[model samples]
Target: MTFQLRVLLVLAPILLPLRSSISQESAPTTTPLHRIVPQTPAELRELFRYTATRLPIVSAHRGGAGPGYPENCIATFEHTLAETFSMLEIDPRMTRDGHVVLHHDATLDRTTTGTGKLADKTLAELKQLRLKDSEGNVTDYQIPTLDEALRWAKGKTILVLDQKDVPLETRVGKISQHKAEAYAMMIVGSFKDVVACHRLNRDIMMEVMIPSHAKVQAFDALGVPWQNVIAFLGHVPPTDPSLYEAVHQKGASTMIGTSRNLDRVFHRRVRDAPDSLRRDYQMILGRGADVIETDLPREIGRLLYAPLSKSPLGHRLLRVE
Candidate 1:
């Protein structure tokens, strides 16, 4: 036989077993991933494809809480497992003891009852401090380690590690060791950091987070389809298209918002205020964004995915909603 046919013959047996092993049980629900693990890369890729059709999927900015779970707490991460959100945004940092832990802000004062730098605290000390909600009310939730968060991702939604202040190598290393691709998978991290991490481990999904409209070129060249672009509303007289276009032309998807990635914006920032946050959303949607991360993901899905709009993912979301 020819070389190509011979190679195909050699690989067929190895591939058949993987296809057979995909035990897809339709997005597990027991406390957010109580069942399912051991997924193949092919199965994971297919799942990602189907979910993208439901674009603008809810991504709990900090793993959405249930009734009373504080934001970014383990409870919230578990709750997210039950939601339809295709992804979750989580922040991870290192403790003084060199253990990986989860928290958003670089400092510890705003989130926990503790009053010092997070890096200054040992894992035991960090765990001693209870986490607080946005209202500054303390709850029973203690800080969680990265291992806990990964456990929540097991055969559930994707994890988008928003480790803005952590070293890329460290974050990527932990995710790889877990073999998260067998469960949910991650974008690994934001724009600048992910570039280095991708070169080190190209199999990992990379996401870019932008504060300003610069640096889309370097991020797009990395060949990843998803890049989380931060959407803003200030500094223009309205009708600004430069930044979104810059990212879209690079073949990477843009995550726009009237504010940051949440798709909510300040009403005061829009010059004419004619552009509702949704209008601003449509602008980037027009740019062919592969995904839109918004707090109002349901509304965006309704409008963009409306029957008449021809949005690729809209139909499915509308039916579900």
Candidate 2:
């Protein structure tokens, strides 16, 4: 007890002062703020409202998982969170058990061990299967339900869910159930889907998926603002980078894909055909693509955030906003 008293006498003054300063630092300040982005949703929205020039943001295709983990699973979403990229593109489908699960195809043969259609399997049966990667390495990342993915991803990152062939209301309902309000960039496969989104989620910043050249004009005429669209001009060939201009003129964002099924990732596969080896990064970006969805999220983030070789358009504007 005498030794303890001696120690307390020696430390009390030092520890008490340290705690006093720590409390001061923890207290809030009354200064006004300047920055908006890398901030809350309201701040981000305000920043968007005032910005004059719109540079496309980085988006990870298929949760940014290359292999082992199943695409669009919780594992994939986790992988996207690891990178500097701010967004994730995932696919959502309903299981026979009436649960919303992440899977690209309607069939389980491509990514899962189960055979036949995804609707055929119960949630229990689906969980038993393994996930296959591009190289055919099957791992244990079982298909994660959309609710499961949302419960984890609500605040961390924006989810660009490729919701094809499913009821739009049903998918939106899953999001609403969480009450956490995760940003869902819904892929509008049809005009009906577009109409539904406009009517239902007017407050949410959406990215409607536009497929055709004609539909682009039609949607734009309907007063679908530039902020609400992401032109999914599929399989965009290098020779036709101009194909995106019409949509861009409408002031909407456009989505570019890069993979074996779409364009190549490398810009200078010179030995190959001009269109074959050259990824559409430069071309699509040249057209002012608002979002470039890439398979290599980390690598693409490096490229996107890299210092620009030239000054942007907003730099020269006489009355730049």
Candidate 3:
């Protein structure tokens, strides 16, 4: 071959890899929400710990009930995950025939076209009812089951299962059956429930009510690893801010409920004011909360992602030392 031909061949291998690398870099990729979730318990623990320092986890209250999508419906979940890195707070209730389904209210009158108590209906009966939005307008979405929700959340956002009326055994059974311990967590009300859930599945993550330091100690006493716990401090602004620190020392994170404060008397000054809302969020973050469970996850996520100067509060987010 001539010298010119040999030179062209020498450049081909080098140029090809460079072009391929550029093409891969330029291609659009899925966001963290759409990517496969953490499969191990240790990875999930690190996710929470790292996220606390980065951005506070935004949990959509009632799966983010709004205009088109109804609360606890699959459509709402998909919409939220597509928009942001969010955790869906869903209520699980049992049907009359023992199927676990998602519905916020004990009765179906407020959120669905159906009437009477939700427990009185079977899965088939629940499926027949169309869901309603916050405005009470009927939508085409049907009630989703725990199984469906778990499966859907497998590779998407994390799910915070509010143990509304479902028994611990039922919830644990579903989580295990779906192999969803990495992406699913249940809001346990009592120590008994926490112990029961831990005993059933050692890797099952739990969100427990920890109103005070004593409660934190109680949880520690249970001998369940703190790595699997996220402390829920309730709707009221915590009276003891140190509880956040205390819990952190135990290798767990804390979640503050801002949804209830939206209507409470103490929060009246900040309830309607945009600036005050931002300040309130800053205060919560300053207090060392790792997650903010809100009725307005979309709005909060937007605000949290904004720069410190552009944030409505006009201040930087407080970091836990």
Alpha-carbon deviation at 27 in model 3, angstroms: 22
**Stronger candidate by TM-score (2 vs 3):** 3
Give per-residue CA lDDT, model 3, range 156-211, as digits (tens): 76788888888888888898999888889888989998988999999889988988
Q: Where does candidate 3 stray beyond 4 Å?
A: 1-36, 50-54, 263-272, 306-321
For residues 105-139, what per-residue lDDT tens digits would candidate 1 score against the true structure?
77888878998789898999998899886467788
User: Candidates 1 and 2: which is better by TM-score?
Assistant: 2
Give all TM-scores, in the order shown: 0.63, 0.70, 0.80
What lDDT does candidate 3 reach at residue 314?
Answer: 26
Error of 2 at 108 (Å): 1.8
lDDT of each: 0.51, 0.56, 0.72
* Model 2 spans with C-alpha error above 4 angstroms: 1-52, 180-182, 211-214, 237-251, 260-280, 306-321
Best model per TM-score: 3
Q: Give the backbone clash total of model 3.
A: 0
lDDT of 3 at 266: 24
lDDT, ranked from best to worst: 3, 2, 1
**Model 1 segments beyond 4 Å from truth?**
1-54, 65-67, 81-83, 182-195, 209-251, 258-284, 295-321
- Sliding window of 10 residues with minimal summed lDDT for model 1: 16-25
What TM-score should be assigned to candidate 1?
0.63
In candidate 1, which residue pairs get closer than 3 Å at backbone N, Cα or C atoms, i.e. clash? Answer: 191-208, 305-314
Please write out the lDDT profile of model 2 over residues 108-213, one tens digit for every residue: 8888788899987888888898888645678776888777877766545667667755688886666566653325556667767777766776544555556567
